[model samples]
Target chain A: MDRQLDQLLSSAGRPALCQSVLPALLGCIADIARTLRTSHTVALAGTANAFGDDQLNVDVAAEKLVRDALAKCPAVVAASSEEDPAERPVRHSRDAGQTAEEASSEQYTVAFDPLDGSSIIAPNWTVGTIVGIWDGASALRQPPAERQVAAVLGVYGPRTTAIVALRVPGAEAACLEVGIGDQDFRFHVIRSRVRFADPPFATRYFAPANLRAAAESPSYMRLITQYVGKKYTLRYSGGLVPDVVHALAKGHGVYVSPVTAASRAKLRRLYELCPIALVVECAGGRAIDPVDGEEILARPLEGCDDRAGLVCGTTDEVDEVKRELLGASLESCR
Target chain B: MDRQLDQLLSSAGRPALCQSVLPALLGCIADIARTLRTSHTVALAGTANAFGDDQLNVDVAAEKLVRDALAKCPAVVAASSEEDPAERPVRHSRDAGQTAEEASSEQYTVAFDPLDGSSIIAPNWTVGTIVGIWDGASALRQPPAERQVAAVLGVYGPRTTAIVALRVPGAEAACLEVGIGDQDFRFHVIRSRVRFADPPFATRYFAPANLRAAAESPSYMRLITQYVGKKYTLRYSGGLVPDVVHALAKGHGVYVSPVTAASRAKLRRLYELCPIALVVECAGGRAIDPVDGEEILARPLEGCDDRAGLVCGTTDEVDEVKRELLGASLESCR
Candidate 1:
């Protein structure tokens, strides 16, 4: 039965690639989730967050699961992120002419933005885990400037979805499309959050983006301001993984590029969320070019690389952000 | 030095008391504090708290520490709380009621509130932890309601303090009181958060008798209120252990006892903070007794135990409350 279930989920993502490892990933994810649930539910009376630090408060089992996976898969050279720099193999002292055996072994590096938007843990906000795999040999040889990534994947809960991006032939040619919302993710396109054709746009706006881009986009800015004025709910997570996870789950998204804002600069990414974009696209959604649709944007090295505006929803809704970028005047959906 | 520190901490409390096991408790506290400082040094990535949840995110080190202590202490009967209900032995049980030689051993049951206020993990709130030690034999008995605890202890940090309670005698009650701001504390009088210059004066004001007591006793209330609010930064741990620890560190204090509008019941204790009042008094903090300063009040299981409006804090403040309850106007202290 276990083998059959594995075959089913594996078959769900065809071509017998790493998808064959779906069962293993799922098992790890489940183990971590259950461990986390138990820990929180039964934490000692006064003990909170498990550790005094906020980042360490993340699912301890989640970190262990990732660590275990990395250790077992000799294919993995490094498995860690801003949340965990400990996973980086320590370099033995060469000053003393240390032998090769004395030096730590190099393995595949799995860089991650672990538990992005974890600040929402207190209020139970949407959070996510993302891992980007880079080639061990190349990663070690290249300077900080030249690390190329092979694959990136992420998962989120409430309704767990596993999104992956593989650098296969015909991949990374264009701006990625994004698909989010509902279990039945049959993809469709729409222009923007506002639709002169759909039900009047009456909900509050809550996406993590640069305040500057949000202000520049007249439609989104007006909606956001009005929503804030009405004292409607607005939550912005400066972290990328969680922000995007939330946007997809909710069906309508908004992100501004070239933010020119200090606060939003932290959300910039080079090679990360693109794979997530691939997953979104596969699900029949669109990730519009933050800039001109014609010129494919390269991941920025220093800062705000993918800061171009991002809006994902049904294909048509996201097109609105694209339309606005293209000098297209949009009628208010309301 | 480690042994000396342990001996110094264990001196006043019962030698076999759970609180006497100061090594693990203090070690975990320092570990948490250090982690918090390191993680929060830069722009904090996410919310973290001092405590860890056992059910949601188990801390292997913490579990091992508590388990080791429970095993070494025979005086402990059955410990139970948010972490575990059954009295798991320090050693594993044999399978299916078989002797150890006959089958694989079963896991021991250890009940602990590994880390409380776990909700703080997400929003970056102050968290604390508690562990109540009981004998395994007693734990194997019936319901938790039937078990009698020998000692309950707690640690709350970022203003580190150890608060304890024990049923044993000749135990010079002590509290690890690290004065906030000043960072110096020793055994001292308890204090309150609400006070009134005179009683009966505010009979028409706040609903409960306790609030009225504060309104009535002007000078005493002022001292208690200021100490309660400014001293602890108005932090409340729904978890009993941290709250008790915080109170102990500040010479003892009180939260507003929840009172319904219609029932003019004199306040005996604050809502969630009530359960630990006995433990607080046992630790040498005064549990306000309207009629007496030294006595601790508990509701009679049967009949009208309706003693309303007690005071809790440093013994001095409690005495002050007792004086007011006797209808004497407070005398000014130089």
Candidate 2:
């Protein structure tokens, strides 16, 4: 009755490092989900994180849980989180037994956003966790398409579920959706190979984030107007995780978070955007920067605080974004 | 450990009829929540409802459960649902023991949308059940403010919760938010009294339903433009129940569904709109028809197929909806 996450990872031929790191990460997410059900207190801790967003007691608590869980994984040499945007050594004890060079060769680094939608959590709306696992000891100065081997998105909604994407260099890319049961809290595979619906669908959905940016960018406003004019169903929840997850679940959706002068991009590259990009690509969808129309996975991490706008989901819809937001501008110059 | 729904109703000075009827209704909703967790099938039943909306397997299952539960309640004389838009007799067994007049005097009627947001349920997103209890044998030929006494909205999300609104003829209206625990599946009070945030808040939210109508109605389009320009956070989930529930939980939100020449109103009055209107009004918010600027509760429910657009939430924002979508047209005459 219990379909463990490790079994699924091993059967899918994921890297040994991923088989070990992701389960530990999910364990922490499951614990956080349980705590949220009973904890009624969402009082502000009166402190800000590295990003300057005010910290809630639950946010800080979730970050500690994720950090503690990663520290237990021997293969996780270093980790960074949105709450604390610094790559700190996870298992310092390993330095005593092995040389730094030897440890760095085999271990992996993780960057995560422990709690993504703290603003919506107060209303008991869905929130989530995003984790990106890289192949080396550090996740800096390289594009996500290079060393990012795996990613897991933990959705804490009506049901506790995770969408796992694995891309080891030699093996086939795979996307799996799994759910945690309330009775035993065990992960059971829901969809083994998740993919966006093939084109020519009867209906389409859109989640336009950073809506205020519409006032600053005429192109972004045009995109929103186009989606509504085409009779696209709107399904935004004002949370990056749920908005994207909705696309994965429904088999067709486009989520846009545009960067404008008055409204800077809020999603961090290393912690949030890169991880979600991996999942979307593995699902046979596309993820790109809405402004430049470049692949998101091709963008370098640079630092934990690097932020970018994203346009991702089903391939055709994402292509339309480029046509309206990017191509339209190119043609107007003529 | 268990804060039963009956206890909450009795303590709130609700009528004896509500105390007996609401508990039975919640028991049905809780059962539906459990079914949703384990059921993976979202196949179409190959049938359409009275409104021509396709019926999914889960939707049909939920409607049957609600009908069966109401039949077991001796004091529920009749019931109607979105799936079956005709008022039908309940508890016919009472006819054997008592005369028709005796049964009619003490009994109540119920109208419900057994499963609201069925379209979103396929993705495992949060959907809900809405039930409104009326004072007589039929919920017809009367304004909701005159006879509707109580309502319950069962939210099937990461945690099962219900927002109960009770407004007996002479008693103070009460809106209580309660949660159903995993261990016992019993309702416990989360917020004893739920109300919208007072005006002059730092942040505001909006959920604009039926966005397709924007193409036909310039005022509706203008309303959305104004909301985005004013920096209102968009939190729409394309579901009426969760959209309104978000407003109650966040303490400030305006949910608008406007009717136009091309896009008629989709929300049902008896099964969907009235129940939510009662809950929103009890929470110190306002619910009104978007086109006419009339109070939703004041509209007479002529039959089971009644339909109307809703603009409900915090007092000021609902007022703004009236101003932008209605008042602007009035000003144009000058």
Candidate 3:
């Protein structure tokens, strides 16, 4: 995967942060890739995370692999993950003895969910890795979505594949960074960079209406009913990354999970909402908060653990969500 | 992988029919499995199947492979699949010069869905291959559920794995024929028969209440609403094989799709229902038709193209289906 990015790697104009971050992340891909490749043997740890979701042996092991691999990179100064209760600082590889004042602003903060939807692992369902790249220490104080340098989601299923959405000024919307589809693909967990930055459009047209729609608020339920009445097919696995990525790949499809009566929402802002918002928005689509009536990425970060409802997909589909589901005026929301 | 099956191969009482069919089918596994192991390179053919569902390159290729590879099995006199309009005869490979009278009753019939839920492939959700083994050409006229000798479902996701439920004389009830968590595991696609037939059961419970519930019958809608009200987690992936297999693994859970107004049912009898029904029933679970209150497997064969509503899973879960969803009297249907 690093070969396709040789131009990016050698380019002079690219930001220094991603120049190191992307390649370093490219290196980190192997750890999780190994877990996915050997999925049949990974055991259930017989435990759950802080979120009360079950943890697989692969999930816990992969998270450590990513942290260890990324920590060694001089560019990764700090990292926050759903697996950890708080962010941990990584000592610069080149400046291990330097004080906090000596560390350069060129470093990055990585916020990620090492393994999303871990519950589905045993069933052999599609699960993924999600990461958000932030500029520096100060960038973490604000909603990382606004300053997100890049968003990467690796879906590990029948194939070990990764999608990176880069926000560099001249960068293309999305890149098939570490793909198995390339001619030089290796059988093991090594990187294979194919041609990068082709706008991935949906080959099949169907909105990824989340399965949780049935019990969503009355308005959301009505929206699903309308979609059903209109004959829009469904494409949802229980995983958020795969569901959203499916819509992004197809270039169209709505994925909604509004704040319901029982809870605020299942998706976390830093780990899920922001990173995915960056992905869809960059892919010629929209991601928004239905009730607040604003772009999801544009919203201020409530906290590290903040949650929000999501209605994300193609531009037209989000409009369908706003106008029909939220009962906002059609042309007004559009 | 084949070494684990040494016991089954050397057992003297093993049926003569499976001695050839199982090994041949085992060999055919590579053809379909190659699609998964090399998933990144398999292009999505811009085509749709006869069912109007979009086709993946792997789906079309796998179907032809299973057909071609299984054709040489002397025990397989004929094969039918969801991909084909009708049953296709398989000439005996070793006795090509012999007349039809020379072929003994040893010949068996096979009905299969070479690829199920092909649309979910691009998004990288779990899809599967389903096979049902029958006695002979004359037995094909009988309800497949009643006479099914062996039922096999191969799930291709993070791992290429299969589950087999055998009704052969002296064969165990439910066997983990091919498993990933075993010792002496290899990296290839080979059978690693686990503990044989011990009446597999559901562990983590969740019904695959598909999104079409809103458009389904009022009673079905209410059933979903009640399940949601009670906070029953969902396990459906819009794939029948994965959903059903999840229930079978956990020991109990229901997967039902009654005839909606706009369609008859999603599962076709010959390809999907009969095969899966035989598997679940053989596993000590129940597969029933809620409307008339009969075993789903006991229903007579309508035709090669016939379809039906499904209420399949564990006995109690299926009972909840009959009592709540179908409004059937308690114990009367059982």
List chain B TM-scores, each candidate: 0.47, 0.90, 0.81
Model 2: DockQ score: 0.39
Candidate 2 chain A weakest lDDT stretch, 10 residues: A43-52
Per-residue CA lDDT of model 3 for B85-187, tens digit only, reads: 4777875555334334325556677888888877666566778888888877733468665467777787766656676666655565544435432122332
DockQ category of candidate 3: acceptable
Residue B57 lDDT, candidate 1, scale 0-100: 40
| Ranking 1 against 3 by DockQ, winner | 3
Per-residue lDDT of model 2, residues A1-334, tens digit only: 2345566576544443554467767677788777766554341111112223433567788888888787667778889998899998886443234434334445789999988887666455677899999988799987679799889898776667788998877778889887766556567777777888886766789999999889877888888998889999999987788888888877899999888878887888899889999999999999999878999999777777988899999998999898878887678777
State which candidate has the highest lDDT: 2
Worst 10 residues of 3 chain A by lDDT: A43-52
Where is model 2 more than 4 Å wrong at Cα? A1-8, A11-15, A41-55, A92-106, A328-334, B1-8, B41-55, B92-106, B328-334
- Looking at candidate 1 chain B, the ten consecutive residues that score lowest on lDDT are B200-209
Model 2, position A39, has a per-residue lDDT of 56
Sorted on TM-score, highest at the top, how do the candidates line up? 2, 3, 1
CAPRI quality level assigned to candidate 2 from its DockQ score = acceptable
Score every model by TM-score: 0.36, 0.89, 0.80
Task: Give candidate 1 misplaced runs (Cα > 4 Å).
Answer: A1-21, A38-52, A57-61, A74-80, A84-109, A133-220, A223-258, A261-264, A268-272, A288-311, A322-334, B1-334
lDDT of 3: 0.63
